[model samples]
Target: MRRLQSPRRTYDWGSREEIPDFLGQPVDGERVAEVWLGTHALAPSLVDGPDGPRSLLEVSGELPFMLKILAADRPLSLQVHPDAELARAGFDAEEASGTPLDAPHRVFKDPHPKPEMVLALTTFDTLVGFRPTAEILRVLGALPTSLTQKLAERLRAEPGFAGIVALVEQLVTDPPTPQEVGDVVAACADGVQRRTDVKRAYLTALEVNEHHAGDVGVVISLLLNRLTLQPGEAAYLATGIIHAHLKGMCLEVMVSSDNVLRAGLTSKHLDPQGLVRCVSGGMSRLARVEPEQFGESTDVFSPGLREFALSMTQVSPAEPAGTPLPDQGRRIIVCTGGEVELVNEHDERLPLRRGSAVYADAADGTIRAHGTGEVGQAYTPTAEDRATPLTDLV
Candidate 1:
């Protein structure tokens, strides 16, 4: 097992305190959004063990999974990730157009599909896939504004998934006027005061509008499912499922890809048509994940993906023998709290504390966790693709 130094990515919609406080680092007063703990080329981790602070790619090769500790301060962009077919086509088209990989307008960063899952470490709130057309109409109808009624009429013109697609396309492409958006918000405020059955939806719209006032996405918020996950709960986001994280912190695991097609709530380049193509799958509900509990202390979050599964082992004084972790090829272990140490078959130790992480190879065999803390392991069962054994050690 080797210690790894991860990179912190900042964004405008990120928390100014949550990430830094959790990592036990001094706050720089910036919005820290995510901590990347894998080799994903765009923001690869570093080998900060005894040897040096070299890039993880040079030492361990390209790992197929990326792990992130995401903390959202406000609603993120309403975005969708492409599935395999769309990803490949988009990537090839961009490459043919001579778009640089780091170009601001570039859509697909890699040819890989991005299927991600988020495990709530706090009371995480998000706007998930589209609600049923009936439900959406009900929410919009509760607002009872001219713009919302027009939107409802548009949705009702076709109704169902087809109508939703067309309406979303219109909203992203030729959005409502700012005054119309404000009317929707005002109507939502009125609905909130009237205590409608869809009060949650109305409140969510106002919440979104608080940050992005007059933005079309605030009005579009009425079309999506409002989901709030308590601590320890999780949501697995399949490709083509549109979602926007609203608040709080979570551990996100995904296939190693950087392609994101966005429609709203961000200053980055928007891809309305591309986002429509990605969401053409017509997903309309959240995929809530049920962790597979191993023994009494370990929770394995595997969403049937060939790429990665997250294993969380709780270490405590009551079980001094330490919880035995499975040997899952190349894995990255992150400590969420307290202090912990991983003991390999050779009795070699890798100490970890809150916000610390380490890279362990399959050659270490089944390691045991000692001390008291929560250890998060990003791994998947893949016998064919395990990295070569690392010989250098502490």
Candidate 2:
């Protein structure tokens, strides 16, 4: 096991102080959004052990997945991710077709699907999946003018996810004129002025659109489920589930890929067609995750994913030397909230604390944990792919 250092990603929507303060570190007031702990090329973690900061890629020879503490001060872009096949195809096509990898408009970054899970470190708000037709219709009924009438008519005539898909297809492929857009905005603004409940949805819809002026994803928000996750709660995002993290901090674990196919709401690449192609075409409902309590010190946060599993544990000062590491696949552990003393097989204790992580290879076997405060682990399982190892982590 080796202690590692994570890389922080500074984005515009990030908080200027949240992450800095969370890690008990000082910053120059730069907006820091995410601190990535895995190897995903864009920001690969380096070994920060007794030696120095050595890139994980150079040391381990493979990037499992990048872990992050995502701090969102504003809404993230309305984005979709490609499944494995599509991701591979798109990345290869871009490469073979002579598109620069770092180009501003590049969409697919790698040939792997991005399935992610977010565990709230604070109260996290997000918009995920599509709202049912009836719910959307009710929201639209409160809007002003013939716009509401037209939408209501559509919901009445053609409801369900299919109908929403049709509407989205139309808006994306054959968008309305600029005049039409301006008119809709005006009507929404008017509705808000009239103290209509629809105004809240409309304003949210409009805010998301600011990132993607012409994308249909702007209006799509009006038809999606809005959710707020308290600290320790989690939400899993599969490929093509349109989602935008609105605010708050969270621990995010995802597959080892960066193949985002965006429809709008970002300065990054916009691949509307690719997004539509990869869309799961199902309504998204609140699937809030509750951690499975493990004794007194451990709570496991496991999203049903094949590639990765995360466990959150709070070690009290009185707890004894904990269980040994699993005799399974590769395991990566990170301590974000407090200090931990890890003992190897031969009883060599290594001290670790916040912002510190370690990679335990399959060959090394299980290590014992004896310390105080919170720690999380992300690892690949050796057993069947269908079963999540969060239940099995001792």
Candidate 3:
């Protein structure tokens, strides 16, 4: 196992204290958003070697999956990722259009689908997928506005997933005027104060408007489901599903891609048409992932993604020799709590502390944890399509 130095991403929506405190570092008053622990070209982890510190890409090439510690103080952009086919087409078209890869308005960063899962380390709040059409209609009915009333009438007339999609597409593609948006926000705020049944929907609308006033995403937020996950709870986001991570820290694992099509609630580039094309208009079932326990204190969270799977193993001092980890395929192990020594079958050891990460190649046979604390492992399952192992790439 090789020790790795991961890179932390600082974004405007990140908490200044959460990541620093988690890493046991002195608060430097910087918004640390995510600590990336993989060989994605955008923010690859570093590795210490005979040639001194080197990029993880140089040591292990491209990893099929990327793991991250994400801490959001505010809401992320309301966005959706395209499927593989759409991603490839979008990337190729953009490349042909002479858009620089680093351009601010560039939508596709890579030609790969990003299906991700987030395991809450804290009370994680997120707006994910579309709520039931009935719930959305009810919320809209509670709002006192001609626009909302008209929307409710239309939805009631159709009353199904198709109507949900049509309403979303209409609002996103041909958005309401700024004055109309403000009126909607006002109505939502009033409803939030008065209606308990639609409280969550209105509260979310108020929050979105606070961040991005007069933005149509405030209206869109009412269409999605609001989920609050406790620690150890997880939610999976498949391609074409819109979501916004609202608050709290979580472990996010996904295929190595950064292609996001955004609609609103962000200062970033807006692509309503592209997002509408990429996002599904139908109601999305909540993807609440339940952990499958294996051995004592080991819970494997496999959301059935072809590229990645995550397992959280907790080791106590009483059980010095912790659980045996999956020894095949490339793995990235991150220590979330306490210190632990990662030992291999060859008696080689790599010590890790809170916030530390390590890269273990497939050749590193049967690994075990030794110490007290929790560690998360991200790896490709044996059942996955190994024909295109990312390590084959330079």
Candidate 4:
């Protein structure tokens, strides 16, 4: 097992202090978005080695999965990720067209699909998938404007996921005018001010408008499902599912790829057509992940994805015994709370405190934690298990 120094990323939508606070470090007044914990060329974690610190990629070739500590103070972009096939195709096409990898408009950074899950460390708010047709109509009816009315009419005519896709395509492909966006925002704000039981759709729209002023995502927010996950709760988003994480901190694990097809709610490059192609034409409800508890405080979060799975174990002062770490695949363990010591089969140990992370090679054999703390472990799943369709998982 090797101690790792993870890379911190700062973004405009990041929380200024949450990540630093989690790491037990002084806040630098900069927005710390994510602390990347694996070997992806973009921001690889450094592993403490016998010869000094070295890139994780040098120690363990490219990992199939990447883990992260994501802290989003503001809303993220309304975006979708492509599936494995689409990712490979898009990456090859972009390469063939000679689009520089560093170009702002480059969509695919790697050829792997990204299917991620967020385990809430705090109350997390996010928008995912499409709302049911009836709920969407109700929200539209409350607005009663030309843009919304037109979308509502189209949805009413099609009345399923197709309608939702059409509505999104229309909004992204041929966006509403600034005047139209302003009208919708005004209507939503008025509704929030007047209604005793304000609809979450309108509230979300008003909130998104505050940050992204006249962006079309303000209106698109109404079409997606709004979810609030309490601490310990998790939600899995498969490839092609449109989503925007709105608030709070979470531990995100996914296939090692950075390809994103964004539509709106961001200052980054927008690819309306690409986003349209990546979106799944099926409607889905909130993808809440139910953890399987073992012994007392160990919660295993497996979204049936062969690429990755996460297990969080909480140890108390009364019971100081640490749980045994997985012995097969390469694993990364992060201490989320308190302090602990990771002991390997040879009795060698590494001290870990809150926000401390370590990388364990498969050859390290059985490892155990010792102390009172909470640790999250990310590892690759066995290849023998048949893959579960993302549609069924959602």
Candidate 1 per-residue lDDT over residues 1-394, each given as its tens digit:
7788888999999999999998998988999999999898789999875656988888778888899999999999989999999999989999999999989899999999999988888999998888888888898877668877887998888898888888888899998888999988888888888788483888998999998988889988888888888987777788988888999999999999989999889988999999988885553646776666666798777777888878778898887688887654688888988999889989998888988988888688888889988888888744422321212110
lDDT of 2 by residue, 1-394 (tens): 7777777888888999998887768978899998887778777888765566788877677756667889998788777787888888888998998887678788877788998888888898888787777778877776654654676788788898778776666666666655566566666667667777552677776666565464556666677777778887777787878777888999898898777776655666676777778878467633555565546666666566657767777766575667444334566787767777877776667777776778766555666777776777777633443343332100
What lDDT does each candidate get?
A: 0.84, 0.72, 0.84, 0.86
Lowest lDDT 10-mer window, candidate 3?
385-394
| Superior candidate under TM-score, 1 versus 2 | 1
Superposition TM-score, candidate 4 onto the true structure: 0.95
> How do all models score by TM-score?
0.94, 0.87, 0.93, 0.95
Pitting candidate 3 against candidate 4, the one with the higher lDDT is 4
Q: When superposed on Cα atoms, how far off is each prediction in RMSD? A: 5.9, 4.0, 4.7, 2.2
Task: Output the better candidate (2/3) by TM-score.
Answer: 3
Q: After superposition, how far is residue 271 of candidate 4 from its true place, in Å?
A: 0.4
Tell how far residue 95 is off in model 3, in angstroms. Answer: 1.7
lDDT, residue 229, model 4? 87
List model 4 lDDT by residue over 352-376, tens digit each: 9999999997677777788888899
The clash count of every prediction, one per candidate, is 0, 3, 0, 0
For candidate 3, give the lDDT. Answer: 0.84
Q: Of the candidates shown, which would achieve the greatest lDDT relative to the real structure?
A: 4
Question: What stretches of model 2 exceed 4 Å from their correct place?
Answer: 49-51, 174-203, 206-217, 323-328, 382-394
**In model 4, what is the error at residue 221, expressed in angstroms?**
0.2
Ranking according to TM-score, highest score first: 4, 1, 3, 2
